[model samples]
Target: MSQHTFLTLDEVASNLKVTRQTVSKYIQAKELNAVKINKSYRITIKDFENFVNSNSTSQEPSISYLRKTKNCTLQYSDKSDDFEVVHGIFHGELRSLSNNGKLTPNKFIFGDNYFVMKKLLETHRGKVDLIYIDPPFGTGQDFNSIDEHPAYSDKLVDGEFLEFIRKRLFLIRELMSDSGSIYLHIDKKIGHYVKIVMDEVFGYQNFINDITRIKCNPKNFARNAYGNYSDMILYYAKHRDNQIWNDIRESMSEEKRKELFPKNHSKLGYYTTNPIHAPGKTLNGDTGLEWKGLKPPKGRHWRYSREVLDELDEQGLIEWSGNGNPRKIVLAKEHKGFKIQDVWEFKDKGLSYVEYPTQKNHDMLERIIRNSSHYNSIVLDCFAGSGSTLRVADKLGRQWIGIDNSTHSLNVIQKSFKEDNINFELLEYVPLD
Candidate 1:
C-alpha cells in the first residue's frame, strides 16, 4: 500500500546496469527495497530515491520469486493449427459460434450453451490468446427466470459448480496456446477446490500465478478472514518457453538513462553490450563453433563457433563490451511507461459496473493480453457477461469472439457498449420466428 511510485524490474535492472536477476537478488538481500509480485518485481521510487540520495547503488537481486519451472504431465501432439476442443458428451448447438469471431458481444445470453463450449471452441481452434472468467461464485441458484437477466447465478451447488467449470475448462484448454494462458476469477467457497481441479486440467507445471482480487469497496461485513476483500485469479500458462511477452517500457528520467549508458548514441540510449569471442576459436556452451577474429570471455566458454561469431559480428546484433566477458548491449529506448505488475489495481470504466457482477478491471485484462496475446490475435470469452473483454479487445485493437446465452445478459452487455460508444463488428442475432 505504501508504493506510491513504482519501477519495474527491467527498468531497475537497466538503470543499475545489471541483469534483472541481479536486481531481484538485491531486493531479496534487503540491499534494495522493493515490492515483489508472484513472479515479477517492482521498486518504489521513494525507497530507491532515498537509497540513491545516500550513495552509489548496485545491489544483487535475490533468486527467490523466480517462477517455479517444473515440468508437467504434458506431451506435444499435433492436432491442427487450431485448438483441440473436446466435444461435449451431452450436447446441443445454439447461436454457438455466431458471436465468436464474427460479432462484438454486448451481454450474456440466457441459454444453456455451456454444453456447447467444446464444439464451439473447435470452430476458432487455436485462436484465443487469453481467457478470463468470473463465473458465478456465490451460493445461489442458476435459473432461467424472466427479467433475472444474465441467466446464471452463484446458487449452484459445489458439485454442480465443479462440473460447470470442468466442462468449460476442457473446451477452454483446447482453445489456448500451449504458450497461452487462462485466468479464472472465483470466490473462496470454491476457490480451493477449483485450484486443484485447474492443476489437474492445465497441469501443475503450467500454473502461473494465483492472485486474490478484492471486489468489494465498502466493507459491509465483519469478523471474517481478512474480510471478503478479494477473490482469486488462478493462472496457468500453456507453455513456459515461447509464451509471448514483451518489455513494457516507461519514460526514464533523462538523468537515469544518461548515467547508465554513457556516450551511447543509439536511440535506445547509453546501453551496455556483450563481446564476441576471439577469432580462430570456438565458443563453448552452445555449438562450440569457432569464430575467426573475436576472442571469447576469459574462463567462460563461447556459445557459438568461430564461424558463427564472425557472422554475428557482421550482422551487428553483437555489440562488444570492453571487458573479456562481453556485456551484450541490451538495446534501450527512451521509455514512456514501464510494464505493469502482476498485482493490478481496479480501474472503473463504464464497463466495470456493467461488465459482470464479477467483471474485473480492464487494465488487468490488458496486462494479461499484453503479455500473452499478439496484435490481431483473437480472444474468446465464453462467459462474456458485460463484454469487458470484448470492449477491451476493441480498445486494444485486437479481434475478439464473445459467447453468452442469456437474453438479459446479452441485452445488458450490448446496451452498455452501445452507450459507451464502443465500436464492434455487429453480427445479426436472429430471433425465434
Candidate 2:
C-alpha cells in the first residue's frame, strides 16, 4: 500500500465534486475525519477514502477520482530571469553616519534595495520581525516635490513592474522570520496583479488581508468613471497563525460613544442597559432557574447563573423595571473599543505640506506598527520613500532598517531623522561586477 497523503479542504472539495462548505459540514458532523492545523483544516487521504466508501454505493475505486492537486501560481515570460541575475561575493561596506551608542543602530541605506537586501541576508536572514513597503505603483510616471524637484521615477509598468516587485519579494521572504509579516501598499490600478504575485511568493494559505485605504477625499473627475480615492495594502504572514498580531482595536469616536451610551449615571458615568435574558433556552441548567420571584421569558434563559444574578443585584449592577424585569447595566468606561476592520481612511497630506511626494500618514503607520510589531522587533522598509515607516517604528521602540536608491529620498530621510535626533548608520551599495 502506498503512503497516504494529506489534502486541503479545497483539494477534497475538488475530488468530491462538492463545495468546501459541504466538506466542512462533514467535518463538523463527524462524518469525515479531519484535523485542524493552525487556522485551517487538513484531511488525510485515508479519511477521504473512508468518507467516499461510506457515502457512495457505486463500485468505483475511490483512488480513481482523487487527482493530485496542482498548486496555483502566476506565470509570465522572464519571471524566472530575476533568480538568474547573479552578483559578486563582495559584501557592501557600511559606514556609520551617526550612532546613538545603542546596542544595535538602526540602518538607513542609500542604495538599490535589491542589492541592499542581499547584503542584509548575509547577517539578518530570518531575523526581521516585520516589513512594510510602499513601492512605486507602476504608473510609468515620475514623482516630484512641490517645488518641481525630481523625487523618483516609476517607469517600470506591466510585466516589468511585476517582475521588479516579485524579485524583491523573493529576497524579502528570505529575510523574514517564521513569525514575521509583510504589508505591501500599492494603488488599485495594478494591485490585483500584485496580489497574485504575492500569493505565488507567499503560499496562498498564508495570505491574510487586502486592506482598502482611503487615500484622499472624494474627487470630481472629468472622466465618466467614479472618483478614485483609495488604494490597497496586501498583508501576508511568513506562516499563518504564527505571526505577531496585537489585535489593536480602533477607539470609538466621541459621537459614537455618546450614541451607544446615552444614559449617564450620577456616580458611575455613562452606561447602557441590556436584557438579563438571552435568546437560547437552557434545558436543565441553573441559568433556566428563576431569580427573585422572576422567571426568564418564554424560550429564553438568563444570561448568567442565578447566583451571579443575585450577586449583581446585591452590588446594584442590575436595574429592575416597573414591570419587575431585571436588566444588566454595562458601563461605557469598561468597554474595550471596536475591532479594527479591513477598510481604513487615512488621507494623505497635500504635496505642499509634505517634504516628499506621496508621503503616508504617520498615524496610519503608527497603527500598523503597534498592531503588527513589538518593542525591539526588527522592522524593514526597502522602498523607504519618505521613511514614514521608519519614523513610526523608531517612535514605537522597534529597531528599523530603511533602503532607498533615490537621492531625494535619502536626503529627506537624513534631514528628517536629524531634526528628530534619531541616530542611524547610513550605508551605500556598490555592486562588484
List runs of model 1 lying over 4 Å from the truth.
Answer: 1-85, 88-91, 94-110, 141-151, 214-221, 247-341, 347-356, 420-433
Residue range 1-433, candidate 1, lDDT tens digits: 4332555564455345456588778788888898656445667766666555555445644312121211211122231111122532444444432333544433233344454455445565566677777777646756442333445566656566676676577678767765567888877878877886676466555677777665556456766645555667887766545456655543466677666555574444566554443334333345343344434444545655555665666766466555533334545453345554455446344333343454567777776667667787766677777677777877777777666765656676667766877645433233343
- The clash numbers for all candidates, in the given order, read 73, 0
User: Residue 234: error of model 2 in Å?
Assistant: 0.4
Give the least accurate 10-residue stretch of model 1, judged by summed lDDT: 65-74
Q: Name the candidate that leads on lDDT.
A: 2
What tens digits encode model 2's per-residue C-alpha lDDT throughout 218-254? 9999999999999999999987788999999998788
Model 2 weakest lDDT span, ten residues long: 80-89
TM-score of 2: 0.82
Global lDDT of each candidate? 0.58, 0.84
